[model samples]
Target: MPPHPRTTSPPRARRRLRRALACAVTISGVLLTTAGTGHADPYAAPFPAPSMTPSTLDARYATERRSIEQALRTAHGVGDTGRARTLGAFLRPGRRFLDFDPRGRGQAVEVIGDLASARRVALLVPGADTTLGSFDQRPGKPWSTPGGGARAVYTEASRITPRPGLAVVAWLGYAAPKTLSSDVLTDERAGQGAVALHRFVSGVHRVNPAARIGLLCHSYGSVVCGRAAGSATGGAAWRRVTDIALFGSPGTTAWSASALGAARVWAGRGGTDWMEDVPHVRIFGLGLGPDPVSGRFGARVFDAGPGGHSDYLAPGSPSLRNLTDIALGRPESVTRA
Candidate 1:
């Protein structure tokens, strides 16, 4: 034969393959995302009690670090390659994991600086897509990794002028909804997260009862903080919180900041934060409620500049600077929105 016909896949077959690949990718994203939305059954297993508050890190560090190492080994053995790398990095020398449980997806508390002597503590509650496996930050990634934003905040906290013995806590304590999934649209996960956050905050207070505690919640985390704020009245732990600053918040379910029950509530959004486009209404408890940054919501607004949704903690940005100022109790220097 002078020539042979070339073999090629049929167009329909090619289309089918592409669709299959897209679906697989979507499912992978959902599965691998640390910030999951599914409601966790409280009865699944007996969860361990967190460390007693005010316990010196010396008493807790050795044991917790061992837990992290054991969890890392389990991840590697189970072929959870993503989680393996994440847990491994966390086991690096000198890095202390305040609390760690590798069971299921995982839960942890990573401190940026010394917590024992710090007079000011910033507890960062992250939004969706935060899990131990996905917590590792790689350059060129956005909000997908916890290290990006949490590390940024940690670094900025240390840079505060006249450094105020501040320690930043990157708490991946609750299960967050998968980003872009239906879970992000509801408050179920937030409700659960709120309970855990409340407990964590209470324990934190017991550790350094005099520390000036501030909550810096981002995205759906604002919903968690909002829920915790509701029942925090008449409690000393809740009263210890000085400022509740929300950025890129979806909603807080409250009509006004005063309803959050914090001493001072502040809200800010990057000029281009897409969260502003999310609807601000409650529907059968399926929605995020109201936008905290809206004029009618009545939160003290701060300057977040014209950054995007993920840029709130970008170093040198006005949002980061303002947050540092607020954390240091220098509200007078914060630029107004």
Candidate 2:
């Protein structure tokens, strides 16, 4: 009777039974098959994963900047040679210098609009690292490339109001900072640049005294504007500069618009920008005043959406549209979208 206890299943048999149970359970449940398996669901699709690569963003900007620069260059070359030549005259090396010193020749650009009536004029001051090369083209290029953010402003002005004569000028006479370091950012160079800008504005007003002039400053350019506004130079007395528009600005809070004598001041910032998070402290007594976009500053604020730092001139952006409206003096056109 005790020997009968040995009548249990063999190890191989037990293993086989376990394997069979596993197979049955697997077949009864939801099945997943590899790509090569014919049992796989044909309709199941993979999701598009979000990109987390910095290189991808850099490549995107590089491609876009290239395309825009090419288009601008083509447009600049095709226009009436007489006007282009005249504008090119100002864009030359000697004319674009900082000195109003008899030796200092100032640079200028005129974008012609409707001829029937007097028009609004916009003087665009570019930010740091902007050269005649970077003014319209990408950095490190020798030849002037067109269709820069400056040109976009001109185009916007032209399209915004076909009635008022619109003359958009890209004034690159000042030497902008070549980098973003605090040393360069806080140098006396900003004040020097401001002096140059004042002269450029004066020269433009001299040419078209009756035009309603608007000053559009971007980034470090805003610093220049603030400085110029605070200067006591006769050149700052120009009556044509009616409105000052600061976009993607970091400073404006430090100086009062009334002190600068700008009739109207407008400030805008694109949402989701890191600049807003940047400490507003002035370093080495060189950094600019306060944040103009802060409601405490009392500037007419417009929403620039989520384009961040460089979104001001991005095509089809709300910031661009708002800029067009502001340049054209179409206050009603600025919607809060």
Give residue 165's error in model 2 in angstroms.
1.0
State the lDDT at 56 in candidate 1. 58
Report lDDT (CA) for all predictions.
0.73, 0.55
Please state the error at residue 6 of candidate 1 in Å. Answer: 48
Candidate 2's residue-wise lDDT over 1-337, tens digit each?
0001112344777545544653344233224321343442211121222221323323433343333333334336555343334334434432221111111122223233421134677767777665433445454321112235656766666666555467565666566664433323363666887777676566555445566777778877777777776663444336667788887676843555566675577788876454553444465574466788876676788768676565577667788878767777776777653
RMSD of 1: 10.2
For candidate 1, write residues 246-324 as lDDT tens digits: 8889888777898888568889988666565456778786667778988888898999987777778877899988887
Each model's TM-score, in the order given? 0.82, 0.61
Clashing residue pairs found in predicted model 2 = 72-146, 72-147, 73-146, 95-105, 119-165, 253-290, 254-289, 254-290
Model 1 is weakest, by summed lDDT over 10 consecutive residues, at: 1-10
**Residue 325 displacement (Å), model 2:** 1.7
User: Which candidate should be chosen as best, given lDDT against the real structure?
Assistant: 1
Clashes of each: 6, 8
